[model samples]
Target: MGALAQLLPLVRSARRDQDQSVLSAALQAFLDFGIKRTSMVEVARRGGLSLATLYRRFSSKSDLIQAVGLQQTREFIEGVDAAVQQQIDRDAGAEAQIVELFVAFLDGLRGNRLLDRLLDTEPEIVLPYLTTKGAPVIELGRDYLAEFVTRLQAEGKLPAYDPLPVAEMVARTALSLALTPQTVIPLDDDIAVRKYARDHVAVSFRVPVTDS
Candidate 1:
């Protein structure tokens, strides 16, 4: 199991009512004022706790940020899982399902107002969380996709290759498109973006054509 798969249970078990309130307040403050400007004192006040209590829960701003990011990542994974299941239920082919999975992931990111705002105005605050300390989230996503790919292989939809490497490629490609779409292709239209992913995924993972 990856680090994220291990941490998910811990994250679930560690959440108390007080901790939830603190994290909620801290996330709101960060969204409102950006990470650098959001102080622990303000978080405490917003959470209706004393500075000492807040500090006891989260020793510093970075700790609180990590907690918030982890929670968000957990939610994102859940949402993506649901979206992928829905697409599978639609009886789409394996390749189309993969494309839909990424489309749903992209849509989830686009729908998050706070994340979008941070990316727009305070990208610096968000970039490090994704680039420097983002292994947990990336691993979580990769593991989930790996499981999906394994299932596809069992259904004979994809070839019986190692799923982990392919899952990693899918995760990395999705993240790249989400973060730096302009570097890859124009994403001005949703249909075009989905087509692009579909084409790329098909070409990358398609079965070999052998002459009879």
Candidate 2:
């Protein structure tokens, strides 16, 4: 199996998140059978949990799926945040960092067995979370990027500007591209994604924005 096919290491650096604990079993079951085929009972059994206990936590399978989407969104943010930071340390510019986040995320999603399975086998179940009803996941990424912009500002990497809108732009663009793969942009091709990010996305960070 390629590295991408491996289960994403849910624990990254020193971040201890409960989403990993709450959703690992569901992730595994979904990985094994895709969300449509995996029942709540199977999820409970895989976790050595009772159906009642599972219901107490998630209320329903749709609820569990929502939690999983939230987990995937948060993990995606933190995971690529670290990648961008690594690029910064390497003296990589904003464009390179953006490319790192963009490609890393899409590549990770491609390798994400559970999510990939959902896209392949059950689009109706998962598409809403990535699209029309995607506010929860998209908003999570936007908020994380908002806080992340502050850190970049402190490092003198970005000028003073409202972080929320900028963060939302990047978050929405990245997530949207991942969901809609059939573009002029060949997202599967890392070289193309890097070029796209450099030309279109990273330009914002290249120039300083003065407060109006």
Candidate 3:
């Protein structure tokens, strides 16, 4: 099928085999020491595998990082999908649903210890993945949100629009808030963040009101 469709099975297989452990070890090392400082030896030691095995599985450090990134992105998208579906099932209003979806996403990001460590100690390693070379993950997030928005439009819960552009706006806005929140806003406050997202984002997607 598609590239992502083809990659899912490999990711799932990695989760089932020693490759998962190796990737986990690499991720842990990268989070702790930054990718540049972390070596293949350290990854092998952390994974309890021989360097040969690590090399055999992944040709280089970049390959391992790419694999880890793909897996992480997949899991992140799955979590967002679940959160959005849960809100939809609750019969929440369109705005409320979007708010809850973003809240859930932000909560996940806040809870990720690896992300916190990377942000605090090695922001450079993470910046590229979010900015310059972030096409894969960004596309994943955009496509997922676009599909969700399309569903809402089909159900008459949101206005009909080109879901891709709208989803891109939503994804980029959410990513910005998650990564570098405005200094003036109390982004650390979950309640305030939810309110801000609802006030700002909901308007864009909400069905326009007309005088009866």
Number of the top candidate by lDDT?
1
| Collision pairs in model 2 | none
Least accurate 10 contiguous residues by lDDT in model 3: 1-10
Error at 62, model 3, angstroms: 1.5
Global CA lDDT computed for model 1 = 0.74
lDDT of 2 by residue, 1-212 (tens): 12211222232222233335558888888877788788999888877768887787666787788777667666777777676666555354444555666677666556656666788889998998788877766677777777866766776666777889888887787777667667787776777778776677666654343311
**Higher-ranked by lDDT: 2 or 3:** 3
Candidates in order have lDDT scores of 0.74, 0.68, 0.73
lDDT of 3 by residue, 40-81 (tens): 999999999899988887777766776777677667778777
* Distance from true location, Cα of 192 in model 3, Å: 3.2
Sliding window of 10 residues with minimal summed lDDT for model 1: 203-212
Give candidate 3's error at residue 7 in angstroms.
6.3
Q: RMSD in angstroms, all models?
A: 4.0, 7.3, 3.9
Per-residue lDDT of model 1, residues 1-212, tens digit only = 24444445555445888888888898899888888899999999999999998887666677778778777766787888888777666355677777777778887776776677788888988887777777766776788888887887777777888888877887777777667756655456678878886767655655333200
